[model samples]
Target: MAFADELKKLIGKGKQAAAQNSDKIEQAVDKAADFADKKTGGKYAQQIDKVQDAAKKAIPDK
Candidate 1:
């Protein structure tokens, strides 16, 4: 799968997992962003940041 697709899948899984665990969503997003940043060699930092921000906003508070 493409990087973006893979990232989306990871985020979806994280969201579901976070719904159950409640405390790991931020860490999951951070790890996803780190992976995306490293995979893209930081070339898409802005996009990754956007994704991270959106994830944070979407995740419900515990």
Candidate 2:
């Protein structure tokens, strides 16, 4: 198979897994965001939160 097609299949599998465990993904993202906020002394709390929200949204809701 072509590299692009292989990559697409991999991505689709990942999306399926993410949808199956969205709650876990969200928890991990929240934990990572909290860690980043603390590491930056909360200076980037708003930006971190925005990124966290985006990451959570990236997971399929299916």
Candidate 3:
């Protein structure tokens, strides 16, 4: 589908950018997870931690 193709392209571009700026990406992930955790008052700590782990797995430190 066209939507899938476009999404793949965007993901590819993001991967390239992430490779160049892994630290910034990781920081952004941390900020976002922290924000979500704060918003939920630690109610979704496990979910946020899972998301953080997934993001770290997807975007390696390279």
- 22-57 per-residue lDDT for model 2 (tens digits): 988889999999999999999999999999989988
**lDDT tens readout by residue for model 3, 1-62:** 99999999999888788888998888999999999999999999999999998997788556
Candidate 3: regions farther than 4 A off = 1-13
Using lDDT, give the best candidate's number.
2
Greater lDDT among 2 and 3 belongs to 2
Total clashes, candidate 3? 0
Candidate 2: the clashing residue pairs are none
- Which runs of model 2 end up more than 4 angstroms from their true locations? 1-4
Question: What lDDT does candidate 2 reach at residue 42?
Answer: 94
Q: What is the C-alpha RMSD of each candidate to the true structure, in Å?
A: 9.7, 1.6, 3.5
Q: What is the total number of backbone clashes in candidate 2?
A: 0
TM-score of 1: 0.64
TM-score on alpha carbons, each prediction: 0.64, 0.83, 0.73
In Å, residue 44's CA in model 1 sits off its true spot by: 0.1
